[model samples]
Target chain A: MSDPSSLLGALRVVLVGTSHPGNIGGVARAMKNMGLKDLRLVAPRAQFPHPEAEFRASGATDILNDVVVNDTLEEALADRTLVAGTSARSRHLPWPLLNPRELAGRLQDELRQPEHRIALVFGREDRGLSNEELQLCHLHVHIPTNPEFSSLNLAAAVQVLSYEVRMALVEQAETASRKEDQPFGTEWDAPLATSESLERFFEHLEKTLVDIEFHDPNNPRKSLSRLRRLYLRARPDSNEINMLRGILTSTQKAAGTKK
Target chain B: MSDPSSLLGALRVVLVGTSHPGNIGGVARAMKNMGLKDLRLVAPRAQFPHPEAEFRASGATDILNDVVVNDTLEEALADRTLVAGTSARSRHLPWPLLNPRELAGRLQDELRQPEHRIALVFGREDRGLSNEELQLCHLHVHIPTNPEFSSLNLAAAVQVLSYEVRMALVEQAETASRKEDQPFGTEWDAPLATSESLERFFEHLEKTLVDIEFHDPNNPRKSLSRLRRLYLRARPDSNEINMLRGILTSTQKAAGTKK
Candidate 1:
């Protein structure tokens, strides 16, 4: 079996528009405590390398030392295979949602492919992830906090999710060690498409829909978003996505010839 | 079955000889986040009414307001029937130990008797529970953290343990309710699409695909089957199916008029 640390290493935490330096430091500590190494920040409102963050990091200063700061969420998630955005209980959009534990379970399943990089994106402290930001993610994760006082401290939310991921990894390692010495069989015939590929496909899909006059740009009733959600939930493999793009190209060509 | 909140309310978190007042406040917030109400302190070094603690507690100041203080661990355990001391791995004494999840399971089992009181004791930031303090407990609970960086921030530790307890209680309540409730959800605003509607939608989808030159009538390549599988897996509601059919009709009309 492959080393579980590699899997753990592949998972990164992305904080977007964080207002507090202390929370970023606390998140570093929490991630280190659970053996998560990668930390990325997008458009943080707080100053990096601030004294408060350093004080809060305690011994986990190493994580803060190598933190990657990005200008946008899309740039932070450009390389990730799967992305899950943290959301509060209620949102206007109906998206594919999973609880923290379920998110861990899904990650564990995805981590079977060691190259499958994943990102858990946390948005602003007060606003949580915006609808536009959340739409970029394949799945939405909601921590089952007390509904009445549902807003969890950002660092605390990271702590809970990191703890769940650690538990899943530890459990997987234990189960692997307990079993006979044999490699796990690959579950999927084809690797899943990356986020970048999926984005391109979605763009092509929107353009083709407009080309065929099926989707009206002037009066869109979130039809594109609904279709995006549908495809994202499907999680098409690389081959399937290629075929889909091919079909879109053919549809565009056919409509152009008729016109 | 007793109320889950009552069980959670009966479980008290005890901080022994804590040096950080912020941790105390943070603990209160974590406890409140998980629906646990009771908090106790034993010989805390930080000032009880410290502003840092109050600031750290966020909106959970109510838990801090109702906090109980004791002079010694014995006083804190006076009324509790079961006690679990949080410890790091590889202590001097080989005592009866359980992971945080196992401790939560034990608590869930003991909670069958509503009168059973429980205490989870956390020690100082620098040093864990003293040998004598740990001796007073029936079980030692260790959080499974990375050995390289073993010390979890005091509030983060509270968050993990409280999260586990909350999960256990929520699961128990869910299992009990699931047996009594109907199999499927009665909460959906729109009823499911009928088989006839789905079949008609599929037929329309096939025709639209052919018109768009996306599907070959002469040289079939299982593309239609794949599309069928995608739609079937989505399980679109009646309104969604109608919307999809409308899109297909629009696509066909656009293609026909262009031709």
Candidate 2:
């Protein structure tokens, strides 16, 4: 299993036009509490070196010290392949609205790929991400708060999003290396199969089912496809793959004998 | 439905050991945004007159003006019957862990009963509710956040929990007065029957269910009792009592016919 620390390193948190230094400090503390260390401040109104920020940051000053201060959102997100903006209100622009759970699943898939760098961007405290700013990201994440009153603070937004990212990474890592006899150290040479690999397996399994007439080809409503999507969303590991494939093979043989 | 404004008055937010004045201000804005005005601060570390707090509060200074700062926890909770503590971590003590959804359900019940004050307490940002402090609460409400990283900011915690309370109240109020031609005003007394009357109906209904063998006599696993407790907790209106009783009769008849 990949260590949470390594996954945290790959994850970057961007805060834009943060009005309060204490919020920056609070965000840093929130990030650290969830094993996330990378924090990038985008033109914060208050100076980061202020005593209030330090006081609020408490023990998380290390994260605050290492934060990358940038003047623009584009600069903050230049390296990130996957960028998610958090908003309580729906925008006029067309962006996929993913609840926290859906966003977590998508993040798990994105993080497994070696080439993906995930960035979670939060806007100012007063008014959240502008439509223009939200357009910069691949996905829009809405924390399923009360629709009557859904004003989440900057640090709290960071905390919720960061916690989801950490959870997905941890669950993925645990599922990947659960079979190892010893405690697997943080570093591992072998890459666990990616989502693409699993997708390929599902495609093969579906095609085989179609060939065996288990799935109706002409009038297919994509039940097999939906099942594949569900498993892909789950991000199954090697042990799970073996067990599932074994079950499929045995079931296929049993059907063949009956025929 | 009950007037949204009257229900707003019943929401009493109690913040414990609030280290930052700005957070208190921000919380005021959050509460005001959701039509909630009552805020009770319990032993703030910093002085309330801090400029940072007022600056962050924006236009919610009225709420700040009406803020009641208490010297002790007992003082803060003196009038409240239903107390819910927000905690991210499990406490050493054996208080039941309830997520926001479950707590919201409980809060809705409490809101129905007149002369009962409800308080939602949020702890300091650094170390959440201490074991001793958590034990003071009848129920510990967890937000059901990402398990890997579940750090919720003090004001944000207030916002989410209060928002849930507001929504639950609105929903219950609406379902209660769906047939009413005139909107119920914020005043405690009205033409409709109060929550106390509704409680009596529930008592009668439970007894009727028991007499008819709808509820198991030997192994009555507290499910019906829990329902009674829930309605008692919610304190229903006259209309809500009538609607629920109607549902109970229909369900009883359906079960009888199937048997």
Candidate 3:
């Protein structure tokens, strides 16, 4: 039901520990290019209204003028339901990583919820997102730049991401209006089954299967992980999850001496 | 069997009469980000090896070092099968116009031919493509900018196009590999029917129709133009074009006419 501009309005660009004033201005310029209005600066190295920052902002002075500065990362992302951090290198932990395009698709799904806001967090130009900062994010976004020369300027990185978000939102709006290839309307759209709900379902299913002597919990193999992948791939809806749980409940009851 | 790298190798970025050294550096950085290795600068204002340009180029020093500077636009676009001029504003003449995404699709089609090279020409930052320079291109590329504030930086424009081309090439490579959704392999893939063949087919179709009294040339009520739209939309492969031409010929012969 929401327009692209509304979706864009709900999206915020948060920069952490920005060193250069020109890049701050560049980020503002880039955000405005994609009709994104909100810019949250977290502990910037440079002061606002610097000459270089103003010079680089070009005509996007409004975005620069209206920026919200925060002293901490938590404050910058306080109201966001979904947070994605930008990182160029691999991390030790295999956090759920998504490329820019996949992140856009996830945004499209999340933005359907009323008043839901998303934050795209960009790290320092030199060292990238701190482990603590990155772990706060639900997903990590990688831009997929050339491996040999992937040191993208902070502003250029912002430009690339904002452009993609704009493209994705615009394309979604066009598809919604045209209704071509898009099956049904928002009326038929099923509520997305949350990760918590999915996890709960998995736990319940595992317990019920063990009660029915179908699964041996003592020496469980890769079945749990494999089934996790299968179900996640299915992206089951809330209704589908409820039906599945009902089936499991019946299976548990069918077992001898099981309530 | 061209890889994305090969496609990028065949593609060239030609900047015409660029005035800013920083923008030039930024362009190189943007090009490298999208795996575009070739850059041709036509009569730049700033001197080569400028410190500011180098500084702005960040880690993409290789792209900056290997740039080919030409005295004329012709040299920059030499042997390019498709030349697209980037213009921010609308011009008087109705040149063949395409947005960035469509331009990528055209590139995908054209690059299939042997030794095919394409030039994406970026004009001066302030003035954009001059009438003379724009005329040199076969198509005009207009990035859809926010009307309220459409003054995109020159390097930003380059970044947008380069990003789009990279995405398009990557998507094509992924599609080719999927092999599931695609109906047949590239060997079964038909060569796109050339304009010459389509034009010839149209001529034959028209002449045969006129002789058989199926079409009246005297008072054509936009029939031919409409049919042109139809066939063009279909984008028939060589085999389909020949089959269609055969049907027209048989129809003409069935009407007892020998041309």
Candidate 4:
């Protein structure tokens, strides 16, 4: 599998009908802090690239400069495989409602497919995504705020959700590294030997053993079968299998001298 | 354990030498959204009741209204039983440094005593808390952010930490019936090969290798043992081992025909 940043980079943060330009700037800063670069605005109410936004962005103006403006949320999420909408209330929707942590876990699973892209959609400041917008998303994410005061600042909401995504990626990388320590991970230098290459190796191996007089044709034994099992268990990489084949060639040459 | 709101209400948010009045309002909003009400300021540069702070506070003006101002950090955390300071860097300090999530877990354990009062202090906007001030706290809490772009907005930092606190409290309430689930180690399509199947494959393999003149009978070079090691590492499932045995049978037939 690829690095966690690869997954983070594939995530698209879409803001729909954001009323305040300052919140846009704050979202940029929050996204940059968590290593998320993709930012899309769908029909923003205020003028972007405004001084207030740049000031709020602090030093993440680069994110603002590169922001993509889409006329509709559908265009922003057209290429995305998974779309998750942020909601302050989970009870109102009959759809799947996940807390931020659960959302992160789901995203990690979805990103296992290399080409998969994810979009985390946030709605307007005063009101969240409309029913139509919510229906477009596969799942709804709730930040689990105080019920009485659940109105999270637009940027603050982005910060919390993005932070969870980053944490999830970090944890995934850590788990992969831990599996490497256990000697079972695919993070090795070379790819495993394919079935075709392994078949060729076995053919060459059997021929050489017969030529070298190590294996008797008239009186067959179980040695060849045992050796086949051993090779299969070892799961030799392509390079290792080539090296074994070379050794078989040398053995064949020596046996030819006797003939 | 006490109710989450009770612990949240008992917790104090102290801002030290904060220069921006707007950020103060942002902090108040973040705190209120997470069910934290106690707000204290230590020698703030901007006016406490500034219009900008009120504007940014949104509807969280109640939290800003009850904010306590103190002359020094000491006065601000005088009554608090536990103190956790926010830091961007966790390396330099010799004191206990915990990530936001870990800090929340520790705080949950510490807050078990109903009489306990905890203080989460934020330093100046530009320089953060002075080393001397950090020394006064029990531990440092670092929000894990992208190392390349680690300048978190003041309010965003508060929002993230407060979000963690709220999540920790909510999770604590749900822990009684919660089951531990691993995020990785995806389920496999097939069960692993049984030892019996593996042994049968091994018997077929050894005979095939000998027949092909690859393995020497009179003067064996420990090839069987080496191959054993390699195959063991592969950990092929039953289907894979069966396919391997079939390959061995084909190799044996080809070698026999050549002889």
**Best candidate, DockQ:** 1
Task: Give residue B101's lDDT in candidate 3 (0 to 100).
Answer: 80
User: Candidate 1, residues B1-259: lDDT per residue as tens digits?
Assistant: 4445556777889999999899998999888888788999999998897899998999899999999899999998999999999998777989999988889989988866767889999999999888899999999999987778889999999999988988888777777777532212223335668889999998887776777778544445577776676666666667678667766766666667324
> TM-score, each model?
0.90, 0.55, 0.67, 0.68
Ranking by lDDT: 1, 4, 3, 2
TM-score order of candidates, top first: 1, 4, 3, 2
Candidate 4, residues A1-259, lDDT tens digits: the string is 3445556766889999998999999999999888888999999998986999998988888889999999988788776656788875643324456789988876765555544567899999999899767756656788877778889999999999999988877777766653222123445544556545666787787776666445433333444544454464455666568657855664454445333
Report the candidate with higher DockQ, 2 versus 4.
4
Candidate 3: tens digits of C-alpha lDDT, residues B109-222: 676566677889998867887899999999998876565666778788888888778778777777676655222112233565899999998898677556545432344545
Model 1: per-residue Cα lDDT over A1-259, one tens digit each: 4445556777899999999999999999999888888999999999997999999988899999989999989889888878999987566557777777778877776665665779999989889888888988988888776655677889999999988987887777767654221112235556667888889998998887777677534447577777776677767778678777877776777667333
Give the root-mean-square deviation of each candidate in angstroms: 3.6, 18.5, 19.9, 15.2
Q: Which of the two, 2 or 3, has more lDDT?
A: 3
lDDT of 2 by residue, A1-259 (tens): 5456555767889988888887887787777766777889888888777787886675788887898899999999998889998876567776887866568788777676769998888888889888889999898988644344466667666766666666566667667767563222222223345676676677666654543344333335454544553354334445345434543443344334222
Model 4 misplacement above 4 A = A1-6, A90-93, A177-259, B1-3, B177-259
In candidate 4, what are the lDDT values of residues B38-129, reduced to their tens digit?
99999999887899999999989999989989999999988888999988675475888888888998888776687788999999988899
Residue runs of model 1 more than 4 Å from their true location after superposition = A1-3, A176-186, A215-219, A257-259, B1-3, B179-199, B215-220, B233-235, B257-259
Least accurate 10 contiguous residues by lDDT in model 4 chain B = B181-190
Clashing pairs in 1: none
TM-score of model 1 vs. true structure = 0.90
Better of 1 and 3 by DockQ: 1
Q: Give the TM-score comparing model 2 with the true structure, all chains together.
A: 0.55
Better of 1 and 2 by lDDT: 1
Provide the global lDDT of candidate 4 against the true structure. 0.77
